[model samples]
Target: MRIVVLGAGESGSGAAVLAKVKGFEVFVSDMSAIKDKYKELLAKYDISWEENQHTKELILNADEVIKSPGIPNTAPIIRELEELGTPIISEIEFAGRYTNATMVCITGSNGKTTTTSLIYHIFQSAGLNVGLAGNIGRSLALQVAEENHDYYVIELSSFQLDNMYNFRANIAVLMNITPDHLDRYDHNMQNYVDAKFRITQNQTPEDAFIFWNDDPIIKRELDKHGIQAHLYPFAAMKEQGAIAYVEDNEVVINEPIAFNMEQEKLALTGTHNLYNSLAAGLSANLAGITKEDIRKALSDFKGVEHRLEKVARVRGIEFINDSKATNVNSCWYALQSMPTKTVLIVGGTDKGNDYTEIADLVREKCRGLVFLGVDNSKLHTFFDSFGLPIVDVKSMKDAVAEAYKMAEKGDTVLLSPCCASFDLFKNYEDRGNQFKEYVRKL
Candidate 1:
């Protein structure tokens, strides 16, 4: 069968390679230029591919299509495929069909990257033969084609979850749902919520569903959706039906294995991280990792790069790089963790964010604001009247310099954009690296 993969980025190229290895007639098409590295890999695999255009005549003949998560169904090519009733699936879904590896899938609006990394770290420390895939590590399709592992820990975004139908996770983790990527869902909150809920689809009673019990969004959604998986709810405080909870200054778990650790001993700090630790601990425990292994790994595991990564402190001022905070909710968490007044650098490609969510936090914690993006009118409209020291900067260099000038001793210079970095930089990693590089020079 002819399997056409759309958007030959990391996931799409990996999917194309996997399809080729499986003896399918594989083709890759990208509207934009395919990276040189990927082009070489595709050619090495002897896979037929195209770039700079999506030829309908070639794409229309596909028996199935593997779509990159970045490509929306609203794209003309995808719409045409839909009109033809052609089956389209995500790389994760297509890879799932070929592997029976135990899947520990994670999804949430915020904290997923850190949590996913934490879980993988714990598993690795325990000496389990595992592979980290999905949004963070290597592509799941690529790993499935090349590597052999007993387990795979994947970070699933709502976009990846959208096209997934029959793929089942042995242990599915829904960290917490929040308003994210609403633009792709026609600006309807429920549509986005439904897309996230897809992570739990096809899960049976034998499977495990872990989530934050305190998240009102997750709670409300749970009431509406009937999840077949054995629910393992986690929370900050002990709830009625919670399996993992903090009590007496300790993280405790009641089911799937009784485990407890001093909360203060966790390597990751702050309330959000406590929740992350609990979720990671529960997931690791459920994966049959010993308590000693889980405890050691949880305390020793370092954090994710772009999410709340700390930069150098020059001239008694701390600079934090939270470039992974692409939404208002994520910024709220970053600001909440600040122990001192912050000169917050924010703005990029706005995703219909409601700044009101972090308005109070900004007022309380931020000494000043530096808007960094090509456009800043929306940020100005919401924050201009707040009477805080605000600066509009189209470039990261100006944003950092202005923030450093505005900061005083014991104050923080935080680069939490709260919007995508596509406007100025390549991606979040580039945005974060630039912030670090510029801050280092100060």
Candidate 2:
């Protein structure tokens, strides 16, 4: 069989290599120029590929196509592929068909990476042979091609979930869904929520669905579409029969098995992370991981890059790089986690943001606001009524320095841009690395 892979980036290139390893005739094509590193890999594998253009003649002859999550379904080429009755699937779906491993898929607007990592840490601590892939590290296709594992902990984005149809998750986690990437969903909240809900699309009664019980959006959706999987809801407040709940300072998970621990001792704090920890704990319990291992992993897991990461304490000023908080909801969580007065460095490529959701939190926690994007007019218009000190800066370094100057000794400099980094940086990682580099210069 012949396979065509679209978008010659990490996901696409990984898919091409895996297809070749599986003895399929693989051809890769990208509308944009392919990087030298990936080009070299294609050469090493003796796979055929082209960059800067897409040849319909070659792509149409394929048995199937593996598309990168970054490419939207509305692209002309994709539409053409669809018109031709070609089956195009995501890297995650393509990879899943090749493995019998128990899949633990995590998806939501925010906290997905942290929860996926926490679950992976718990399983690893239990000495389980598990592979971490999808959105975080290596592509799932590449991992499924080279290594054999008993389980996989995958971080699923809405884009990735869009192309997945028949893939089933033995354990599925839905963190709180909020308005994120609405542009891809025609600026509709239900459309975006439906994309996140796709993680549970193919699950059965035997599978487990873990969710945040406190998120009203999730509850509303659950009421609309009753799930077939066993429901496990985790919440900060007490719930009558929830599998996971917090009482006083301790978190308790009942049902299939009972496990309880102190909330204050959790490695990740804040109400947002409390939900993340709860989701992870419930997933670990379902996997038969011992409570001791879960407790150790939850207490010792450091964190992922660019998401509420503590950079350094220079001159008694704490600098935090939360560049992964790309959407307004993510920034709200970051702001909610701050303990002292914050010099908030926000603003980037706006994704139809509703800043009003975090307006009250800003009024309560922020000392000064630093807008770090090309355009700050919308932000100014929104927060002007709040009557806070706001400064507009052109670069990350300027923003950091300005924030540092405005901040007191006990204050925090938070680089939690509640928007995409495409305006000034390649991606969130570049934005986060620049923030860390600027902070280290202090």
- Using TM-score, give the best candidate's number: 1
- The residue ranges of model 1 lying beyond 4 angstroms of the native Cα positions read none
Of candidate 1, the 10-residue stretch with the lowest lDDT total is 174-183
Among all candidates shown, the one with the greatest lDDT: 1
Candidate 1 lDDT, tens digit per residue, 1-442? 9999998988999999999999999999999999999999899999888999999999999999999999988999999999999999999999999998999999999999999999999999999999999999998999999988889999999999999989999998888877878888898988988888888899899999999988888888896778999999999998788899999998999888899989888999998998889899999999989999999998898899988888899999999999999998999999999999999999999898889999999989999999999999999999999999998998888889999999999999998888999999999999999999999888
The estimated TM-scores of all candidates read 0.99, 0.97
What is the C-alpha local distance difference test score of each model?
0.92, 0.91
RMSD of each: 0.8, 1.4
The local distance difference test score of model 2 is 0.91
TM-score of 1: 0.99
What local lDDT does model 1 show for residue 362? 92
Clash count, candidate 2: 0
